[model samples]
Target: MATLEIKEVAKRYGDRTVLHDINLTLASGEFLSLLGPSGCGKTTLLRIIAGFEHPDGGQVRVDGQDITALPANRRQMGMVFQAYSLFPNMTAEENVRFGLRVRKVDAAEQSRRVLELLELVGLANHAAKYPHQLSGGQQQRVALARALAIRPSLLLLDEPLSALDAKVRVQLREEIRRIQRETGITTVFVTHDQEEALSISDRVAVMYEGRMVQVGAPAAIYQEPTHPFVAQFIGISSRLPARVVDADQGVITVLDRALHTPRARGLQPDVALHLYLRPEGVQLQAVNGKDPQSAVLQGTVRESTFFGAVTRLRVELDGGQGVLADLSTHEALQLPIGIRVHVSWQPDAMRLLPAELPI
Candidate 1:
């Protein structure tokens, strides 16, 4: 186990800059995930950490030792790529033993380590099978075992589960987390999938166009996103136009209804604002009786979609604005389309941001 640090990292390709002033620190045995959309520089940052690519300007350190100039082979890092890079002619056991053989470990130690890694990845019985005879999931397990056989100080996973089927991806992700915990290895996983990053990481760093937008625990990133980009990108949300009626008092007016909100810095009175509300934050109730503590907006159900235990309803406000509300399937069926309903949410559930902010 070791601590990993990336300080002031920057990368550029010709005139386009992909990474800018990237700085992050990982504690010993911590699992940190780099999450973003395609072309967001997550994979590039991972390559820099693995010593596969040099940063234009920065330092990569492991346990207080500078490794920015170290070559890939001497960095003590193990990388598992998206495609299974197993040798087709090598059996599973031999593939796991190859790393040890490169380092010239004795035959006895190599054999013991191979057995342990195969068992660790739950491929002990298939030790004699070659990559050609194994399933995609099995092949990935072999690759993981091979990466771990050398006992690297850091483990880098570059979208290692993207090519598998949905079921297999979920299963393998859980297995990877289990193995990481068992070995307590410092890991950096790069993925474009938000669910994967949120489900398995101790901390998540959300990136956008060469810059990190937010870094926090999964719940924090989901519940309290500091930037408008983060609130919209991290989850499903409905945006409605609003106005800051009283900035000092943290009051806003939406759809001609006055409501109090949290104070935001740099907000001025009478400025146009955008209110962001998550589906789970919006509540639907019959229009007759209403909750006084919540801010209510009258709307009619436009459509409802059932997704197993949960149902999502699209409600169109009297002003022609649409908002989404999530409810139990049982409850949603009680209210059909065209039925008048009251949409309400807690004051704290809505986020206020400048309307000019892009995305």
Candidate 2:
């Protein structure tokens, strides 16, 4: 296992910057995911780490040794690209053994290692199958086996499961996590799927535009987001405008309702802000026979989306502001379209961001 360090990494093309002074460190055997939308520079950073792309400024170090100038072949970093780049002429076993052969390992050793890896990825039964004969998931398994056959100190996976079907993606992600744990290799995975990152990674780094915004445990990233982008990206959230009514006590006014949230602490009075609330945190109840005092916000159910155990309802408030609330299927059934409802949430379940942002 090796420790990976990226220090003050920066990249630009012509007048536009792609990454700005990015810095991150990975502990040996830690699995970290670079999660963001398209063109957020996550793939670019992975390419730089794999020695596929050169960084204009900053160094990439593995185990305290400078590897920024090292070529891809000499870096001993195994990379699985988005596309499973398997040779059509090669069988699964041969694909897994290719790296060992390239490294000049003896034929007997290559055969032994290939069999072991095929078994590790649960593809030993399909070892002799050609790429064209195997399913998408099976081909990806071969690709992973090939990457691991080199026994590289670091592993880089760039959206390796993005091409698989939903069920296969779930199963393969679990398999990948198990293999990483058994091999204990420091790994970096890049993906845009929030659920994928949250379910598998030890820590997730959320990137936006070209910068890494927040890095933390999956639970923290989802429940205690420090950035507006992270709050909106990790889950379904509704952003509402608010004004700081009392900075010392962390009181903010939203739609004539004053709520106190720790996230609003230290803001100057009269400061405009954006309040972010997740769907699960917003509580919605039927307005029929309900006490008016309990209704902090009133709205009409505009849309209902079924999602297995929970259904999300989009409510259009009195002033035309819309917010989302997730309720159980049974509860959602009781509140159909055109039904009036009241909405409220606990104070700690929200985060605040400055109202002004780049348009």
Number of the top candidate by lDDT?
2
lDDT for predicted candidate 2 compared with the true structure: 0.91
TM-score for each of the candidates: 0.95, 0.96
Segments in model 1 whose C-alpha atoms lie over 4 Å from true places = 263-266, 289-293
- The parts of candidate 2 lying over 4 Å away from their true place are 288-294
Candidate 2 displacement at residue 256 in angstroms: 2.7
| Deviation from native of the Cα of residue 116 in model 2, angstroms | 0.5
Candidate 2 residues 1-359, lDDT tens each?
Answer: 99999999999998899999999999999999999999999999999999999999999999999999999999998999889999999999989999898889999899899999999999989988999999999999999999999999999999999999999999999999999999999999999999999999999999998898999999999988878788778987898999999888988889878776676678888977888888888888888875565457889999999999999999999889999999899999999999999898766667887777521
Report the number of clashing residue pairs per model.
Answer: 0, 0
lDDT per residue (tens digit) for residues 244-299 in model 1: 88777777788998777665435788888788898887888877665455646889
Structural RMSD, model 1: 1.8
